[model samples]
Target: MGWFFAFFFLSGFCSILYELVWLRLTMAQFGVTTALTSIVLSMFMTGLGLGSWGAGVLTRRYGQRVGFPSLRLYALAEFLIGCSSLAVPAELAWGHRLLQSMTAQNAYSSGSYYLASGLLVAIILLPWCTCMGATFPLAMAAIRSRQRLESKRSFSFLYLANVIGAVAGAIAPLFLIELYGFSGTMRVGTVCNVIIAVSAFALTLGGRASARSSAPVLTPGERRAVTAQPKVLLVLLFMTGLVTMGMEVIWIRLFTPYAGPVVYSFAFILISYLAATFVGSFVYRRFNTGGEVDPYLSWVLLAFLGLLSLLTSDPRFPLNTPLRVLLGVGPFAGWIGYLTPMLVDRWAAGDPDRAGRAYAVNVLGCILGPLLSGFVLLPLVGERAAMLLFVVPWMGMAFLPSRRQEALPGTRMGTRIAAYASVVAALALFFTTKNFETLFPDREVLRDSTATVIATGNGMHKRLLTNGIGITQLTPITKMMAHLTLASLPQPPRNALVICFGMGTTYKSVMSWGIPATVVELIPSVPRLFTFYHPDGATLLASPLSHLVIDDGRRYMERMPEKYDAIIIDPPPPVRAAGSSLLYSKEFYAVAKERLQPGGILAQWLPFGDEAVQSSVARALEQSFTYVRVFRPVEENGWHFLASMQPITERSADDLVRRMPAEAVSDMMAWGPAATPTEQFDRMMRTDLTTQKLINRSPDTPPLQDDRPVNEYDMLRHWTHYVHSGMRNWKPDQYGAGSNPPPAGESAQKGNE
Candidate 1:
């Protein structure tokens, strides 16, 4: 039992690691702008479900009839899983290439391309993930044969080890990412798989795994114990799998804003969930040894307490507020954690045949859950409403007494009614404490497969949040972004590509140039929401010259090499958000450089939220571009980094204004403190910095890399160090490397406001 525990533990860890990285890799290929995440997850779970059934059949028919031990088969499954770690990366890279080729065809829209890529990913991942499912059954069969463990004990001990390993697999990558990049992490997973195979092979040499003959058929007493209420048990298992998996999807969305959109954000929630689940299962292993199980009423009470934990979690709680965040997320984590493994233990009873078949049924429900949440629940009712919907069924489920519970006729009606009212009171608390949509204004909420887009405020005051993170806003600050970079160019710019369509401000400003423009936005809903921000959004969306593309900025550039005069990258803010690292990586700049025409410029927006982030951005820009210039976008704390392979000449404010197309000048002044174009240009010129000089001050500043993402991970450190001690605004040295940067000139003041 000890040896088998170790063997399964290692395999469980490798399985999660592979699943985590592969999912990220596939999302990159297919574009995770829709419910594509749900598709990939569903497909992976579907493979697991099918594989469990197939493994049971193979073990029953061949292992017993052919006179071979199932433990040896477990060894082979581990080897195959090991082999898959190598194949997966290569296959995903190829799929990305295929997606690139397919995107060039005018016949296909972005939606169809995503669908095709999804199919390719499914084909690549299903085989390895299916092999993952086989481990549970094979190990169970081997343990049962040894007679060192009974049906109940076998599943509990094995489940405990698997989940413990799963907790590690889910979290280790976040720390490993700084040491080893995406490819490096995948290699680490392959190594773990190899360890599992070797360990399992050792187990085959002795112990119950060594048994080659089939055991006698179960006696009447054992048969009855295993078969009792099999139908109800299966149904309960399915419901748990479905509800938990569906809520996991919702939880990821719920927690993203609190954790930031960083790569590790999802891992934090997963770790919390698995950790809590391990606690529950561990508790069950200790207490649930006998044939008797806790009644459903007790489980219902726990569920109510869990709902309280979730209801208290403010949806818009700042990521930096740890206590509030933990309080908010704790409830859901506690509820599912206790119920899942406990229920599985009861249904399977450690019988290899029953365990394998029953676990497969649960996995199928997991497959459906994500699809149901992403496509049906999320899109139809929105996040808050969906959460409320989950509570209704959960509370209702607890009210119905299980078959095991025998109540004297009508004796406990008052007690039951009070219990029901308590559940309703918790629901009422969640509703009265509503309106955490502070991430954006309360104008309109739009839900799609990709994200829930919310628009708030009115006219140019509107803000946007794709999911719960503040994405973009309608403001003149955005207008200045287009004019500042374009005006800085020494030569006339004829074409431009706006990488992110944030409130369509930069895109609209570019169109004001009246030149050919291309706007590439990742989320489709964001582009569609432009009308709510800008009055003329409809005209710009319909413009022949303004080409709006629903594709990833990086992927779009990869598909088409430098074909524009200038490209402005206005990525979503806080600089530490997930996927932000990819945009800031040195490699992306290399890709962007290929598409620029001669003397072309790439303007990047950097919200100087932290010193590390500011330095990291500067370092990356320095590494990529020959001539890099940094400007203070506002008098307070934002920056604009203009980088160009072509030398950037510093023209006087009047001279630059003279070169602007008449319409471009009009766009700059349209929403500014300045009454005229010259005044707006003067505001941009007041805060220029010699980029090389600023880089000199931060000689030891580390650059943001694909592997070591300094921007995304530093917030954890910041939350601890700066939050405790008052955070100081660490401004870089003087504009000319004088160790003191003068404040933005008074002339730029009105415009900044």
Candidate 2:
């Protein structure tokens, strides 16, 4: 039993690792967007469901002798998973580089890129994902065959072990990712696979040692015999699996939009699910074991929980944290605890020989839940509302005839009424708590007639968490220095581009200057509903001067045809989004340079008070552009960068301000270095350093484009900077003991504001 659980847990881990990295690799390699990634995952999930069902059929016909051969099958599957993963990165890199070398003059032919990438994904992932889907159910059958139990115990124990394994799998990846990069993780997974196969094979050998037949357990005759089933039990299990699978998939998908970029919401969701499953098994054992009550009611309750949990979709959903926690831990445990044991017992039929079939069916049910959700439900209503619709299954579950009613010695109307009232009360609270408006301040309360509320976090205490990284606090008066800096730039710079539209501050700033600007933001919600919180948000969203493009900035620039006079990369630092690091990469700068007209400037905000980070980033940027110049708005704070395609001739601070557009010039003279009377302003530009050559060379570093990719040096750069910043109270404006002092310049002050 212990060995079975161990192998099962390890198998779960391998499956998740394979699934996660496979999707990430596909996206990076082939540019498979979120929508397509969802499809691929759904397909794998569907396969698992089918595999589970198939395993059951295979087990019953073959008798209890299938476990020994199943171990070998498990080993082979692991080998396939490991080998495929190792081979993929190399293949993709080779193909991509080969294409680049061939198309030196033209970048890449779109047809060739898609063809090679698609072929690569199919070759590497399709078979592996399929194999992963097939493993769990078959393995469950093997374990169950070894553990002879009563009908109910058969299914219950199998699910219990599988969930335990899932818990183990869910926790290992975090440490694994840190210990080994993606490729290393795959290798480790391969090793884990080998271990599981060995253990399972040993178990099979032991189980068979005392038996009659030793050759692969399931013979041709036995395979044919497994077809007979209790139709009622199979139907019930299938429906239960299908509904649960669909709900899980839908819930997981829906989380992508609301879950912050860095939070690893899917992993969190999976972990919670496994945890819940484990808890549910224990809870079920304690409360409902020994056939005390009909298992159907418990399942119905769980199905209901899965269905009604969709109310957490609102952006203003106040209890996102608690809701997410529940989403993770609740339904999975509830369903398993209340529903799965009954299915197990039914299949086991008070016999240990049939335990494998029961376990296989339970696993099949789990896979089916996600498969149906992704392929059938998600496509129909989209991820969000589809989750809400899961309620239909729950409500339907409630209609199932309770065996308790038929078998109970006595039933009182008063007791039934009291139970009904309690259930209603619990459900009412669930609905009310989940509703966004009920949890957070209403739009009307936040509407300030005096000052246009620029942007408020959607929920009470709702911090703007992008990709799981927190960006800003949700206080009424959020800091506007960053936005104001962009806004205060000179008016009508001919053409301008801004990336990262937090609160639409940069957009408003550009509009104020009357510059025709394009904003590229990856999140869909930002541009669509920016004005809902702030009047300026609407104006910016509605601006004719503003063109909004939903894309990664690096991607947008690589394909952009027109050149801009000023490109403002107001990326929310590496703090908010890991993807932001790509913006700071040398390849990114190269793309930025291509989009700039001659003498045009690219202004980037680098949060580097630390000299090392500043130096490394400066070195990386210096590799791409020319005339890298930095300006400090005040002593020990506010570092702004202005880089150009052409050299920027040295000029007095006042003269430079005067040459700029009126708004920018006014800003420079006012709240800028000129405005801060107590602080000193300075210029930091390395004249001798060649910025262009710093980024472009290196046979090892791949040239970044819309298709080709680059290493994530920016994450390291940010970490390095953060470490140094913590050590030193590093201020951008103030020069240090060893640092160069501010450039000497006496300029005529203009009270432009």
How does each model score on TM-score? 0.86, 0.65
Please give the lDDT score at residue 396 for candidate 2. 48
* Per-residue C-alpha lDDT of model 1 across residues 224-301, encoded as one tens digit per residue: 876774466677667667767777777766666555555556667677777777777777777767634445454445
> Mind giving the per-residue lDDT tens digits that candidate 2 earns over 442-546?
332121111111123454333333322334332211112222233323432676788776555455555556668798876554555465534566666676787
lDDT scores in order? 0.69, 0.50
Lowest summed lDDT over 10 consecutive residues: which window, candidate 1? 732-741
| Total clashes in model 2, counting residue pairs 3 or more apart in sequence or in different chains | 36
What's model 2's lDDT at 357?
44
Which candidate has the top score in lDDT?
1
